[model samples]
Target: MRILVSNDDGIFAEGILALIRAVADLGEIVVVAPDQQGSASSHGISLHRRLVPKPVDLQIQNVEAWSFSGTPVDCVKFGVTQFGEQHPFDLMLSGINEGRNLATDVLYSGTIAAAGEAALQGIPALAVSLDGPPFPFDEAAQVVRKMVDRLQFKTLDADTFLSVNIPAESVDGPWVVTRIGAEGYRDRFIRHTDDDGQAYYRYVGDVVRNIEDDDSDITVVNKGCISITPLRYRFTNEPAMDTLKTWF
Candidate 1:
């Protein structure tokens, strides 16, 4: 299968490199990723500035790689739009993200955003994330490769994609299909003064899991299981529309 791989962690990140290595045996891989960090950039595309994708040597023989001066979503856009005619892709993979993107994190994760972009464009996609530090990037990637091999991409809809979150440790339980649950962090901003006496603030946050959420991504990962959540592009609340119809 021809695959288009992209990530928010830039081209040289260990996680992306490991992902490339893990999936190399699958098929022809074309990687177009951001030149720098793009973690929580979400689905915002660069509209004003010219997005130029520069060819970069990833040192991985036979695998074409490019570095784009844009967000993760932008990288996917550039790749699929510019190269789709010549090298039509069968699948799109994003992440092996350095950090976990679970629950509400999907709203702000550039990793998921990239995969979501592909899903919107009639392509099957998967976004894999690693939870916490001491991340076994290479190992997590291999798990994704195995999972991908088993998944029937043909069954997936044009507006659907999968959001996968792997535990920092080994998975002892079964990989569970869960819903996006409550995940919130306490935000803190420490004020600092620069040499010019200008006030600056450094942001700090800590993850708080909803232990009560049994059928959720956060709780699933905490229980030593891989969380696989099928995400779709339809945001129009069907139930809410019914309620609105009564009001009108």
Candidate 2:
């Protein structure tokens, strides 16, 4: 199986490197990732600027890597399309992101966007993330390795992708299948005054650690279990179709 790896974090991030090392034995691997941090870039592609994939030396044996000056989605797009017929990708692993992407946070996450782009191209993908700082990327990579192995043996549905979140400490329980939480970060704003007495509000958010629903991704990770949420591309609200019809 040929695997395409990418991340929102720059090409040389430790998390991505850890992930690459863990899954090295899987198959032919090629990495195309952002040249700089594009954390909340979502699914944006470079439309105006000329895009290029610069060959990068990750110093990892037998793995070809490149750095792209675009969004994470761009990396996945370049990896899937530009590799020619012989290097068709079977799977994409889009993170080991330094931060968690839970609930609405996925809407803003380039990490999730990379995985989403791969899924859009009919390739099975996984977006892996660590909860907080002091990230144990090696441990998370090992866990992701097992998940990837399972995905390799048992095929994933074409339209689906998995978003995984690991805790800062050791994971205690088994993989808990969960859904995206209803709520996102508990946000706040702090106002600061500049030299000219201009006030600027700084955005601050602490992710809601737990939720009432045990099956929600937010709560699952809080309970010391690795949360695995299967996701698919969807925006149409079929349930609201009837309401719209009545209005018309």
lDDT of each: 0.88, 0.88
Model 2 over residues 8-87: C-alpha lDDT tens digits?
99899989999999988887889999999999999899999988779998887768999999999999988888872566
Off by over 4 Å in 1: 171-173, 206-211
Candidate 1 residue-wise lDDT, 1-248, digit = tens: 78899999999899899988888877788999999999999998999998878898877755789999999999998889887758788888998899889888999999999999989887789999998687898888888888878874456877999999998876334799999988788899999999999999998878775665788887788888999999987889888999999999
Cα displacement (Å) at residue 35, model 2? 0.3
Clashing pairs in 2: none
The residue pairs that clash in candidate 1, if any, are none
Model 2 gets an lDDT of 0.88
On the 0 to 100 scale, the lDDT of residue 19 in model 1 is 88
